[model samples]
Target: MSGHVSGYLSIPPLRRDLLIAYLAAAAVTVHVLEAALPGPGPWFKPGLANVFALVAFLRLGWRGAMAVTLMRILAGSLALGTLFTPGFFLSFFGGCGALAMLALLRMIPSSGLGVVGISLLAALAHMAAQIVAAWLLIIGHAGILAALPWFLAGSWISGVLNGLLTYLLLEHFDRHHALLTEP
Candidate 1:
């Protein structure tokens, strides 16, 4: 009985490890694209990898999502040679906030709020974490106010995009493999 229960609690073997690997690769790819594309602003990012993070959270729970997120961050930072830097910390915190929001969304039905709602919540979390990081490490007290506008705009836009993309991808996977439905 205990073994059966443990099995039930264990993550379903649905190629999640492969998916995590793919997501990590995707993150590296996106980071490279961002560097090569030369965006108008420093903060501009597609946040392409966030799609996987949300999916992991929804399907595999917080621990799984955090594992993937941390791995992605570590690999991504290493690839970009930004490890132990402020950028890595910002990304780490942002991912943590987004995952937390995704976990929260699990309590709600997927009908009304759905992915968009989750995205908004995650975006706000991401922004809040960044702001706190800035205050503590970058600029101190005044940094919060200074970071407000950019944080708001960035989080709103990025969150919505990430949410929409994640919804689409998850929907696709659900239809074919029922990835998120597995026990």
Candidate 2:
């Protein structure tokens, strides 16, 4: 429990809304810490915090997923002082793309994809949307095109790892739902 913030794990499950709020707070905390870590650059994060949205997608459906994603981005950006900035827009659009892609994949009968499949597609979508945002809002043109390879590489690697972690986590929760709330 080192570095765990006080009152973070102390949420009372009085209602579903409260639970979602707690989850959003946890995701935002993860986002902030992950952003603080050393990485390829400001634009590159392993995106471990994104698992919250993926989990919401799997357990609560796409609406919950989008809700969690949006809340996480808003709260995280506010915490990191990125609100209303280019970074905020990037986070916002990227999340929207991820949820939309996940929804599309879910609509097709027997895409036969599980967590990893959804995660990969969503990650690519998120990156694409972010890149497009950057091109339109900041980077402007071919200069940003050169960064595509790096972004894609990061997305694939992190997406796979995060997806696997989420799969295992969901499996664990399925077996131990009670344990999750025993703060």
Candidate 3:
């Protein structure tokens, strides 16, 4: 009876503490890379840490994803010396938007859509949050009309690129680490 009870209790194969450590490290590395790399646009970033965020969401649900996102933003801001700056606010709100999009996606039933869909949705949410944040905190207006063309083009291109990279990383992690299969 005890053996059967133990068998029924499925313990997580990976330790939560270790996962958090790895995610934090990955976030730091990605943030540094973003700071160092030069892209065509001003805010173009690979959003490499988002891979961990997506994996956390898929594996451990909203709490896990939110943990990773918050940690990543806080740590990344500290690393870049932008802890109390507008950048941190942007990242925080953007991350919340992304998480909301992922949570919403989890509610829907869709086939042939995988991490790419999550990435795209998250990217769009991130952009929306940034625009809102910009207007409320920086510009004091929508500012959409002034930078309409650039905003559209840049957001589309950068979001697609970030989505593609996230999808590839997710596939790789899914096979190599099995992180996505935890839940």
Candidate 4:
């Protein structure tokens, strides 16, 4: 027919969709796996899946990261069967906060800070947003926000861990692929 590849596993999705399906699938796997792990508390999650966000931001730019994050949220929720539930809303808003922070932080020169700084800041925003959502929407009390300290601390630790991982991956990709180093 037309001068385009046609098949279930054709190149169109990867070329046009920009590999969002693959990203979403990976995110879903991570989300499901992370849920099964025990954390310090109900408010604490390692957020390993977010490692992809940092990578996407570095490789694909803000728009790509945004798409990946949105798809991750939707697909992750569906996989976990948390869609439309309070958990999903919390995750959605928290992801939005993280992405918003990342978008702003990208404006920085990235001299003193790198993926580590970005990840830590985004993690803080994510935790803060989730806490606020819980307080205002779920708990309906200001006191629930008190746990923010612990959550923020957890976010910092997890963020640094994930950020380092992202940095390593980017370093490797840039070294091998060389696209990121282009000016």
Candidate number with greatest TM-score: 2
Could you tell me which 10 consecutive residues in candidate 4 have the lowest summed lDDT? 1-10
Q: CA lDDT of each candidate?
A: 0.67, 0.76, 0.67, 0.74
Best by lDDT: 2
lDDT of 1 by residue, 1-183 (tens): 110101112444556666666666776676656656766565555666766766666555666667777888888888889898998898888777777776676556433565666666788887787777777777778646675777678777877888778777665655554344553
lDDT of 2 at 71: 93
Please, what's the RMSD in Å of model 3? 7.1
lDDT of 4 by residue, 77-179 (tens): 8878889999999999899999999788767643366678778888999999999999988999999888999889889888888888777766554455323
Q: lDDT rank, highest first?
A: 2, 4, 1, 3
Q: Give the TM-score of candidate 1.
A: 0.77
| Candidate 1 clashing pairs, residues 3+ apart or interchain | none
TM-score of model 2 (CA atoms): 0.83
Cα displacement (Å) at residue 181, model 3: 13
Model 4, total clashes? 0
Lowest summed-lDDT stretch of 10 residues in model 2?
1-10
TM-scores of the candidates in the order shown: 0.77, 0.83, 0.77, 0.82
lDDT of 2 at 155: 91
